[model samples]
Target chain A: MKSERANRRMMTRLSIFAVAMFGFGFALVPFYEKICEVTGINNLIKPAAAVVNTQVDKSRWVTLEFDANAHGLEWEFRPVQRSVRVHPGEMIQIEYDVRNNGAKAVVGQAIPSYGPKHAAPFVKKLECFCFKQQPLQAGESKRMPVQFVLDGALPADVNTITLSYTFFEVKGASTAPAKGGVQG
Target chain B: MEAVHGHTNDHSHDDHAHKPSGIMRWVQSTNHKDIGTMYLWFSFTMFLVGGVMALIIRSELFQPGLQIVKPEFFNSMTTYHGLIMVFGAIMPAFVGFANWLIPMQIGAPDMAFPRMNNLSFWLLPPAALLLIAAQFMPGGGAGVGWTLYAPLSTQAGPAMDLTIFAVHILGMSSIMGSINIITTILNMRAPGMTMMKMPMFCWTWLITAYLLVAVMPVLAGAVTMTLTDRHFGTHFFNAAGGGDPVLYQHIFWFFGHPEVYIIAIPAFGVISQVIPAFSRKPLFGYASMVYATASIAILSFMVWAHHMYTAGMPVEAQLYFMYATVLIAVPTGVKVFNWVATMWKGSLTFETPMLFALGFLFLFTLGGFTGLVLSIVPVDVQLHDTYYVVAHFHYVMVAGALFSAFAGIYFWLPKWTGRMYNETLGKWHFWLSLVFFNVTFFVQHFLGLAGMPRRIPDYALQFAEFNAISSIGAFGFGLSQLLFLYIVIKTITSGEKAADRQWEGADSLEWTHLPSPAPWHSFETPPVVK
Candidate 1:
């Protein structure tokens, strides 16, 4: 009877440990998000905000193209202009129009990426809608502006640049402010 | 103890003489040996099934273009092959070894909970069936890879649901099995057989059982989240709904990394037994081996993020994980050194088991070195999802775990069956498996280094030649297992008779005290250790 009791005790203890580990797995969701928030790891929307001023490379014209994507959100998003030609250091402006097609109010955040990955450091954004979360009521439409200037030293071989923004719907509590640098 | 002895004495006639015969014997079996035998047979059947899938995958990659199967089916083969092999074949095989040996080694009557052990083993076949049946589900098996990272898994068809359920069942089985092992080892050892005095195999299984109980539920939770995300419109992994996909990776790898050790540590236990038996010496640094195995298990938890380096992380986190991942090599190195030192000055004989053990030592080290290489973030980013990663794991899995399993099977066959296997056929089995295994997987490192991504039906012309060679080796390796099957059957039915102590160096309770073909009920009256 003593050994049987001991066996049951051990099994109970292990079963509880296993159940606790199960909770720990779900707990990792929030725990990891907090780590990402504190550490800025894999937080793609947290842009590195830097403004570089130099002589405009008027001699070399770099073609900049804009693209927009809405991932799994009931929003119609598009860039107002398809492409623009600009000098390397010229501060240029572009617009994107987003319309919420869903019945309920929705909050979304935009993440930006560069065409040639190396071009990310060279392009500077003076003001961009991506710096904040956009909340729109049902059937609401809004036009957002993005202003940026390329560094005069962008690489001689780089003649073309493409800037892309993808908007993702933020579920649950969207009260927290968008993360990272906000110089607007 | 007297009452326990009385109970055990009632059933300890000759080998299986008092046991019930016919199908119902196994169907409702409470005997440890019967359950262990069932586990071994089931694991082998799954091994062959998984092996055939591997062969199918290889034959498709034998050429430069889509030669035989569609890319979709190819993806399914790779996915199911991984699932079946890990969950169905390797993990259960080690459990089989544990069931067969643990009680006898510790001089116990049986597992602490014999009925629970039966349920655990019986749970496996249905789970395996669910996994195989998943492939035929209306859009084919879930090709989200074995990790089952979400977004892809959520978007996958009905087959993903089946895979999730199968995983849930398998996890339950593993959890129950681990509980049985832990309780058996902790509560049921013979009088005076303190924890330290128990055999090395028992120690490793104890640690391994703890790990299984810890992480298997994490895996279940992950798959449960995936299940809910698929049907309930939850966004646990959908980035569009505030959930990040990388969150899934974090949780999966947290379970996944430890799962690797769940397979390998038991193999380590098996090798520890086999190596010393062949070398005719006591194990070198027994305490250190235990410490190293524990250290490896603990370190396994921290190094998980290393598996997802390319998935993106802060440079500091990357560096931290990178260093933490590399730190595992220290404990692993201690283990490898101990195995070598075990054979340093002893009277070594290259029996079939020893040959497999040596092969495990050599190739597992190679796998470990490659693992160290992959631990460097920059190097892993280059080799991530490539055949190089493929080559690394097969070395660890096939050569490391599977080879060790083979060694244990050969070493214990005589004790289990009361007959010696044909030595010549066994040697042939070992040599053929060794050569063919390398031929199959060795070139995969080259293909991976050449930038051939894994899980693809076709490869670029540059990788064509190596793919061809690897496929040829796979067929050879697959065929050799048949010879193993034949050898085992031959031994069980009509091989030469074996003495009580089949191997003079096997000094455990099973060999020292129990007769050949260990009695249906051993240690009926508990054997005092001191």
Candidate 2:
């Protein structure tokens, strides 16, 4: 009888631990974002709302470089303008042209990352084409625009911030050859 | 006195029982031993299945120009091979050992939850089926590698969902099994067998069970998120949906890093028992060994990001992970030193089990050292996703965990089967496996250092020679396992009789008290452990 009670208690404790760990797994998403925010690692930068600072720092000029890569997607993706000189707190727009070179219509999603990762916090994206999936018909081409403002609070030491986007083919969005041929 | 009276009452209740026989016995068995046997057989079958997949991989890599299988199929083979071996073969093999031995060692009638034990074992078959059947699916098995990093996994075919479901089922089985182990170890020890006084195997397993419960659910959550992202329009791993691909890696390795120890600590237990027995000495620094195991478990959680050094983590995060990863060597060094000290100045015998344990000690340390080297951010940046990483894990996983498992099987087969195996054949099996295993994995380190990337079906001409040599070695290792099968079958069918005390130095209750082949229901009347 005593052993039975002990067994029940242990089981209960173990079950609770299991459940807690499961919750903890979900907790890691927000925890991961928090850590990224603190450490400025892995391009997991949380976008901040645009700051309306009346005073602008015109003395400092930072170069914002645009880069694009398409992984396993036969889409020709490139930034229209390679690099731009912008003052702190200045809003700028850039265009990227993408064409589906494949035989059928395709859906693509662009994922953005900022290099000189410390600068990720200051480069706020007010409106970006990366926010949604872009579907293109066969032999179709489209120009996508990203509008962003560099916050005035940007760090002094960082001069160059390279924003790169890699477009991946989204599953279930492409109706043609949906099953087998997609390579990672 | 009350315990003694309870034992008498238990004996009287069992006196008139008639045991079931034949197929029905196994199918309906709530007996721990029966369940254990089933687990062992199932794992061995999966071992062969996974082994065949490995051979296919080696065969294709022999010439490095898509010789046998296509690149996609090759990817599938590697993915399923890793999944099947880790989940289906190695984990279940240790669980089989735990089920068969834990109750007897603790002087208990059976696991605390017998029916749940049966359910856990049975859950494995369907999971294995789902995993295997995935290969025959519309596209193929999951080819995003065993880590199943997203974006790639998101683009995979229908088979990916099957793989995810299989993983969920496997995790469920592991959680239940862990709970059973924890309950039995904590609550069901015989009277007078205090926790500190228990055998090292039980202590190691108790720690392992805790690690399992803590991490398996996390793995379940990771895969479930993958399931939703793949099918339910969830953006957990979709970047366009504001999710990061690296987050999948972080979550996966959170479960994955502890998982390395999950496969390892039990093997440590097996070696701790085998080393002392063969040396005719008590285990050295018993209390310290337990503490070291705990320390390794605790440190395991902190070092997970070491696997992600190349994933562009912050330099500070990399430095922290690197230091914590290197700190693991301290406790691990204690374990190695204690094993050596146990064998120091004692009458020692070179039985098959001891030979494998020594091999495990040597090769596993080499693996550990390479792990240390890989933990450095700069070195890992160069070596990540190379054959060197491949060689390093096979050293730890195959040599560290698998070789120790062989040692355990050889050491305990007589007790389980009531007959001695052919020692000559066992020695031959051990030597061949060691030689061929080295031949296979050693050269791959050079290939990796030479900058040959992993997961490629075709490699540059410079890598051809080593790839060919490694392929031949893999074939030799695979063939040598046939000898192990024959020896086990021969022992079970007919062999020299085994005594209750199979080895002179074995001091555990299971060895000292049980008959040659332990009875169907062990310790129905529990022994007082004094």
Candidate 3:
């Protein structure tokens, strides 16, 4: 009887631990975001607007290469410019040309990531079409503009950054506006 | 003390009653031994089911070019195969060992909560059914790999929901089982068996149960989120709704990395027991072995992102994960070294169990080294999602865990059944498994290095030759397992009776105190350990 009581108590404690760990798994979502926000690992969501300091680093020339891909969607998507030379901290603008080649209209969401992921924090976007869903009609072509400034604090050893986007078809997204205008 | 004495009196009285007959005996059994037997048989059935799926995959890959199965069907096969083998086969098999052996080893009467023990085992069948039933769902089984990366998983058919539900059930069952184990070990050890003096197998299991308690819920949570995202308009993994797909990888691997150790630590316990027994020596570095197992569990939490290196984590995150992953080799190496040291100057015999242990040590280490190679960011970038990754895990999972399981079974079958197995057949099973296993996976390393990706229905012309060889090896390996089944069945039916101490060098209470074919009621009056 004594052993049974002890066993019951321990079982309860262990079950509680299991329950707590399940909550911790959900906690990991916020925990992961916090870690990525601080470490700048896979944090592609645009950051809050900072004070516009008109300072540009003239000594470093970084090549910004743009790449675009469409997955399981009938669309022609590519960067208007393959690459651009920009000074660190200089504000720049570029466009990606996308056309819906299929007969029917479609919705797409562009997910972006920075290569050499160290540059993700420093490459702040001022305006970009990737911030929302894009709806394109048959034969409709659009030039999506992206405006961004690279932080002067980017490490000296880093000289190139690849900004890539893959467009995925969004089901049931046709209810939203065809052109959900840019946030900026 | 009075309560303990009263319990003994009650059990003695209860032992004389007529036992439940026929199927009711199994269906209503609250006995640990009965539940343990059920768990083992269930796991073996899943092993065969999963093995058949693997052969199907291998046969299709023989000549490449989509000859036998469609690409979508191939994806489903790979996904279900991994899920079944890992969750259905390996995990439950080890749990069966714990249920059967732990109380006996510790000199306890039975599991702390036998009813819960029964519940846990019973939960497994429905879960297994759900997993099998997934293949017949309207759109077929989940094509999303067992890893179930988000967006891909989110886009899957109705079967994905079934898969998610299956994971939840499996996780619940594992959690309850772990709770039962932790409670039994902590509260039910015989008087005088201190924590430090407990058998290494018990120690390994204590840690493994803790790991299960910690990680199974995390897996439950991940799948729960997958469920909500698919049906409840939650954006846990949908980027458009502010959830990041990479976040899903982080959450899954958090559960996943520890999961590798969950399957392995008990195998370590099995090897630790077998090596010392065959060598006629006490385990070398018993204290260090305990510490090393604990360290491996601790470090598992830190290295999860290694599985996601190609998913575009930051340079610093990659470097940290890589270094931490490589660091696991230290404790793991300590374990291997100690196993060797235990056998160095001691009398050694090559029993079937020992052969499997040696195979585990040699092959698991090879898998570990390849794991180290893949830990580097550049190498993983090249090898990620390739056949090399497939080869690496199978080495660890199949050669490492499955082989050790085989060793444990061979080592303990005599005690469990009171019968001696055919030595000749046992050795044949071992050698064939060793050679064919290597033949099947060894060439996969080359295929991976040559840039052949995994999970594809067909491959380029260059991969044809090695794939054919691998398919042949796979068939050989599959057929060899039949010998194991035959040996087990034959031993149970008619074989030489086993002595109380089944192995000459075994020192555990189960071997020394219990009679062959241990009675239904073991340690009714708990034996005091010294």
Candidate 4:
């Protein structure tokens, strides 16, 4: 009877420990994220918003190249303008055309990449079509606009930045593309 | 000299000793020996299934072109082979050993929880079914490696769900089984047997059971996250949704690295017992052997990142993992030293059991050395995803754990069956296995060094000759196991009757106190240790 009591007590304790380990496994998710943030290893966290330039820099001109890619998606995507030259403090607008070529409607999400990667923090998007998912009807075509200003604090020696957007097909869609977008 | 005690009062219940005949006997049985038998048979069956998958893989690589299976099916073969062997073969076979030997070794009447033991054994079959059935589902079995790194695991088809569910069930079974073992070992030892005085096998199992309880649930958690990510739109591993895919690797190796020791420590226990019995001496450094095993288990957790060296981490983290991984060799070296010291200058016999244990020693140490080579971050990155890594693990898994299992089986067959196996046939099995196993794996190291990657169906013409030789060796090794099956069957049915004490050097309670073909119920009154 004494050993029986001990066995039961041991079993209960071990069971509780096993349950805690299961929780620990899930805990690893948030714990791993926190470590990544602290160590900046695989940090996907966005950089803090930069201070807006109060004074316009009139002397510097940077060339911006617009590029669009449809990754494994049945869509025709291209930028309307090849490139634009602008002062660091001037806001500029560019348009991209995307058409669903498939028989059925599809949703897409766009991701942006920058060349000379250090320029990423200096270029800010004020208003962009990529802020939300775009759902296009079969054979529907739309031109979406991106508006942004380069920070006047952009590195003085860097005179060119390439902005590219890649669109991936989202498997299911419940939202419509931008309303009142310019038709190309 | 040993005394045969009066156990007249030990057999208090004739009903408990009486074994029922038929399928229901195993279906509803609560006996530890019966459950142990079931575990051995189940693992043996899984071993064959996983072995066939290996042959398929070897066959495809026999000539450096896609000859038999498609690329997808080939990937599936590799994935399932690893899963089946680690989970379904090596782990359970040792549990089988623990079941059959622990209660007898520690002078317990039975496991602490007999009904729970039955539940644990029964859970394995359905889980195995789920794993095998996964291959037939739409979109084929998941080709993600056994670690099942996510994003790929999340995007894999319906079969991935089946694999995940199977992993969950297997984790549950392991947890319950470990709980039962821990309780039985801690609470049921005979009157005079202190923790320090318990048999080496029992001590190793005690540590292994704790490791299992702690990590099996973590594995369940990893798979559960994978499951939710697949269906519920959780971006736990999806980078597009702000989750880093590398996080999955971190969580998996956290469980996976400790999992390596869960399979090896028991094999160490087996060798610790077998090496002494054949050498006709008490184990060398018994206390040190226990300490080394404990230290290895504790160290297993800290060095998981070594497996991910090529997966990319900060330079400081890489350096830390590299040093920590190589540090495992110190305690592992202690175990090897103790086994050899047990044999040094002692009168030795070359019985089948001793032969296999020696084979485990020579080959496992070789595996350990290669593992040390891999621990250096720069070297591992160079050899990453290569046949060299493949050869290193096979040495550990097959020659290390499987060979030790063979040693334990040969060592204890007489006690379990009350008949001696044919010595000549067993020696034949060992020699053939050793020869063919090396023939199959040794050249793979060279192939890896020459820049051949693993898990591919084809290789450059430069790697062709070794691949051909390796395939022939693979077939030879696979066929030699049939001879093992024959020897085991012949021993069980028709071999010569054995003495109550089969080995002169075996000093465990099972030999000194219990009769051969250990009774259906043993130590019921608890033999007092002196």
Q: Candidates' lDDT values, in order?
A: 0.88, 0.87, 0.89, 0.88
| Candidate 1 backbone collisions, by pair | B388-B448
lDDT tens digits, residue span B334-444, model 1:
999999999999999988999999999999999999999999998999999999999999999999999999999999998888889999999999999999999999999
Q: Candidate 1, TM-score vs. the true structure? A: 0.89
| Models sorted by lDDT, best on top | 3, 4, 1, 2
B196: Cα error in model 2, Å: 1.3
Model 2 lDDT tens row, B373-458 = 89989999999999999999999999999999999999999888878998999999999999999999999999999999998888
Docking class of 1: acceptable
TM-score of each: 0.89, 0.89, 0.90, 0.89
Query: What is the docking quality class of candidate 4?
Result: acceptable
Of 3 and 4, the candidate ahead on TM-score is: 3
What does the lDDT read for residue B516 in candidate 4?
72
Question: Per-residue error at B313 for model 4, in Å?
Answer: 1.5
TM-score of chain A of 1: 0.70
Q: Per-residue lDDT for B29-131 in model 4, tens only?
A: 8989889999999999999999999999999999987889999999899999999999999999999999999999989989999999999999999999999
TM-score of 4: 0.89
Candidate 2 chain B worst ten-residue window by lDDT:
B1-10
Worst 10 residues of 4 chain B by lDDT: B1-10
**Total clashing pairs in model 2:** 0
Task: Tell me each candidate's RMSD, in Å, in order.
Answer: 4.8, 5.7, 4.3, 4.6
